[model samples]
Target: RSDRNNAIRSPTSIDMDHNDQDEVPTASLGTWIFLVVVAAVSFWSQATVTEERFVPALNVIANIFNIPDDIAGATLMAAGASSPELFSSFVALFITHSSLGLGT
Candidate 1:
């Protein structure tokens, strides 16, 4: 048990964000609500930026490259949409030391 804990706490691992004391941390209801709100806003902002900026920029690139709209959407757009999954898989395998299986 101690060895497993030590492995989890190794320097290369992501910070667990806990105190040295062996006690569970607690959060108030207000704090939980605030965190939820912040998460929602963050997701909203990310989506807005991607839709407003990223996709249009890709479209411009496709035009500059003289790519057909269908081909561009099928290739570049599909790649753009799948990038988050690829990046998350990379993080899971490398940073989190987890396997990315079919479900992951």
Candidate 2:
């Protein structure tokens, strides 16, 4: 238990002087507007493509991989529903190069 605790306490996670908090940056109105527009476009494009193409493509991939029909249907359905989230995650990682992107 003690070793587990020690392992989790990285240099940044522990502070002897208690001065490790990050200051939030304030964005301008134009920046906020731009962020909103970008997010809206991302969501809209994801939805449009998902509805028109993602399911069919996923089916093709599953068939090519020789996945069982029963399991493939369920897996593809779940992936289809989560496509937006997966797309956003990739875009965030690319844009911010961070685990989590800038939150709105």
Candidate 3:
């Protein structure tokens, strides 16, 4: 058991041991700044697109289907929130034959 523990604590194994606090690694300040800037830009772009295009498209869809605005919005929101998980589950069950995505 001690030999196993020593092997795990060896230099090469240090990289694989996530629980070791003494050798914690982190991204550089520049990398963190770049990530923050990229995230902000992405969020801004998504918000702009949703405001300029998605809302108008949703309105048009509701009008075409004669769906109440609230109902259409609720349905769209629910579908948007669930579709990724549903697709992942299908892929996990059928293509990958794994339960990982279902658990997620």
Candidate 4:
């Protein structure tokens, strides 16, 4: 019926007006600059920590295990790089009850 057809709305029926687009919000310049500074500081700290602590710890571990420096470093770096993905998979499987992360 015409009444039912009028009542139903398709995805394309949503407003696409220029005035509405202009009213959409965005982050200010100051907020963007602050985020850049925070990111720079985060990268700097990570580099410093790796240089000062991680390398020395790796050397000690290599010495203890009688493993070559290159092998130990490579193994640890691979584990470190993959840890976020591994943990995300566990979280997706257990907490979120999804297998999406594992497939990724």
Clash number for each model = 0, 0, 0, 0
Which regions in candidate 2 have their CA more than 4 angstroms from the true location?
A: 1-24, 58-73, 79-104
Model 1 per-residue lDDT at 27: 92
- Give lDDT: candidate 2, residue 100: 66
lDDT by residue for model 2 (1-104), tens: 99999788887666654653555578999999999999999999998997789767877888899988788878877987877888888788887687764461
RMSD of each: 13.5, 15.8, 7.3, 6.1
In angstroms, the error of model 1 at 24 is 1.1
- What would the per-residue lDDT of candidate 4 be over residues 58-93, giving only the tens digit for each residue? 789889999998899999777877889999888998
Instruction: Residues 32-91, candidate 3: write the lDDT tens digits.
Output: 999999999999999998789878888898899999999989997577668888898889
Window of ten residues with lowest summed lDDT in model 2: 15-24
- Each candidate's TM vs. the true structure? 0.48, 0.38, 0.56, 0.61
Q: Score candidate 4 by lDDT.
A: 0.84
| Model 2's TM-score against the true structure | 0.38
Say which prediction, candidate 1 or candidate 2, comes out ahead on TM-score.
1
* Model 3 clashes, total count: 0
lDDT of 1 by residue, 1-104 (tens): 98888776867453456555767688999999999999999999999998999889888989899998889878997888888998898888888878773366
In Å, residue 25's CA in model 4 sits off its true spot by 1.7
